[model samples]
Target: MVLFLYSPLVSRGVAQSPLGAPRATLAAPAEASFAVGQQLDANLAAATAPLLAQGPSSGSIVTYIAMLSSQNVVPNAPMTEARGVVGAALAGDRLVVRGSFRELSSALRDYATDPVDPPNPNITSAFHIHRGSPSENGPFQYALEVTMNSTGRGGSATGDYRLTPEQIQALQNGLLYVDLHTTRNRGGELRGILMPA
Candidate 1:
């Protein structure tokens, strides 16, 4: 009679029987290991590949830069030496505006000699993207509105205005312009056309 005994160690690739007799150990399958390595390499390549090479994807970001000047204001303000840069970006559902001013008057005075009080002191001014030229009157549509920082030098604002596809096209076509309004000049203190950056 032949007696056969099974050992856990032998099943796990050990080269010895339960009675300590030598046996040939089985090697791990090389093809299976190579397949695992190939799968890992493919996953890594997919993760690092660029999504967009030509331009931004839909709902991606579009940026514009504006050079602000009082001379561009509708009804043009007095030739003050105030000038600034206003940057805007549309990303997803949000619109962001950032700006910095130099040689700007912080006083609560308008273009006229009259001294006026601002409704909100923290907001030194207001910025807007208008549908028409800064000089155009009536039926003005605001594309975006941002409150100036309290420092009167610069600030930023962001909002979810859900810009429409037509609005985005208008922005790209130069049909949009930035208008800045201060306590003194309610219509606009500074103005500039938006252009791609």
Candidate 2:
């Protein structure tokens, strides 16, 4: 790389020519002018807002990073060798769970954001988040939206959900699990406790 010093201005307002000669002093450019004070807009504020809860309860914000495997399946599908990872974020009463799941023993089906069919056809996820510990099967709580290909869905899952105070505590306490339902094992082909990625 070649750096040709064409003309660099000295701090004293004198211009130094490339030939190592000093030129006449040049007036500094005027400062830039603005109409307004450059106030922040709503979108900028919303985008830059901190994700974690703020204030005296800020310490309660929790992040869960964990994995899901056949080993974590409550009933134990020994024949299946599927695995998954969960990443979750809890800010105040809002929680979003997202993860990737693969290597299932059978075809995936019926993934959703809720147990009942979503009112809007646009909601096309079938993954289920249950309120259970590793040792037991719990009721379905939230549904994760997953993608579909020529094959069955459940290859990946993501969903943002509003939660109650109790639900928030349960999630922080590691009492929530992701349930992957396949055609063969309707109960749950694979399971992983959710934390955020």
Candidate 3:
């Protein structure tokens, strides 16, 4: 019976918290939300086009943040209870989606440019993906998993999420993105938005 309101960056600039909104169970239709250059969509293609057009902005990181939510349902499990990872990567030009693990898995990433020197390496993080969801109780909502890397595999330093070389290339060229990888019948889904970490 809680309600959460959002400005949706694309909608307006209202920085309000979307905490208590109705959700749907996997038993219901699965919905997805995506973030492109400026528009959000329910379709995957709508999310990829923007990346292709702007190649991660050279030594820069861009994130197509996806928010998955449900309608009329409550959460029966913890965010960690879900099995497997629910996202993909497109190396430079290739597109990959829905990589799995077990239940539902979430991931975040930071994209940095290749270092140029020892002092101020040219390689620096262009973008970052941080897990924004709180670890508390609430209705089912979209859990963010996976992030794009501009630097190919082996170029990463911190550990949490990993991307293949191909995936890194794809992200650099605006090809990689995260998608739903849930195996349950929950109603909440993913909504994406391209923004700064």
Residue by residue across 1-197, what tens digits does model 2's lDDT show?
A: 22222222211111111123442322332112110111111111221123432444533444454456667767766467565655555656766565665567777654443334335444244467878787999877877777654445336666777887878777767788877777677667777775432
Winning model by TM-score: 2
Alpha-carbon local distance difference test for all models: 0.47, 0.54, 0.28
What are the per-residue Cα lDDT tens digits for candidate 3 across 77-171?
32443222222223233332322222233332222332223423321332222222222222211222343334221111111234557444434
Error of 3 at 92 (Å): 15
Which segments of candidate 1 are over 4 A away from where they belong? Answer: 1-59, 91-94, 107-125, 134-154
Backbone clashes per model, in order? 1, 14, 61
- Estimate the lDDT of model 1: 0.47
- Cα-based lDDT at residue 106, candidate 2: 73
Residue 100 of model 3 has an lDDT of: 22
Output the number of the lDDT-best candidate. 2
For model 2, what is the error of residue 137's alpha carbon versus the real structure, in angstroms, after optimal superposition?
0.6
Per-prediction CA RMSD (Å): 26.1, 19.2, 16.6
lDDT of 1 by residue, 31-118 (tens): 3222222222222222112211223443455555566788777665655555655555555434455554444454333323332243
Candidate 3, 76: how far from true, in Å?
24
As a whole number from 0 to 100, the lDDT of residue 98 in candidate 1 is 52
In model 3, what lDDT does residue 192 have?
24
